[model samples]
Target: MALWTMSFLLTGCVIKQHQSLSFCETASPIYISRDDVLTQETKRQILAHDVVGERVCGWGRSNHTS
Candidate 1:
């Protein structure tokens, strides 16, 4: 069907890159509290968020945060 074919074509792209970039543009970075515990999983998540933000939004480059 035409509807089904259109939907199929619309689904193709690099995995989550578009959505992730949009999130990087609009979403705020996660805040870490001095008193909060940093588990391994929590550390990994924080690292990933910063890395993605850096790559997509260029945060932390040349002393820029946004």
Candidate 2:
């Protein structure tokens, strides 16, 4: 019983750490195109909704190559 409890606690801690690490690793800057026809107000709302608690690193047009 004691071993099972210890294992459960360790598993929970590992899962929590993994989630945080993954969030940081995947939190890259998002690019928004000027040609998308999005108003400033609309853009702010979209970013706020998508990013939630995370800070946006940067925003601008994404360069594309043919």
The numbered model that scores best in lDDT is 1
TM-score of decoy 1: 0.50
My TM-score estimates for the predictions, one after another, are 0.50, 0.29
lDDT of 2 by residue, 1-66 (tens): 999999999987774434345444565444456567888997787676446425443333233233
Q: CA lDDT of 22 in candidate 2?
A: 49
Lowest-sum lDDT 10-residue window in model 1: 57-66
What's the residue-level lDDT of 50 in candidate 1? 74
Q: Which candidate is the best by TM-score?
A: 1
Give me the runs in candidate 1 sitting further than 4 Å from their true place: 1-21, 61-66
- Across 1-66, the per-residue lDDT of candidate 1 in tens digits comes to 999998888887436745344776586557676667999998888878877877777776322233
Give the C-alpha miss distance for residue 13 in model 1, angstroms: 26
Clashes by residue pair, model 2: none
Q: Candidate 1: how many backbone clashes?
A: 0
Query: Residue 15 lDDT in model 2?
Result: 40
Q: For residue 12, what is the lDDT in candidate 2?
A: 79
Residue 41 in model 2: lDDT? 94
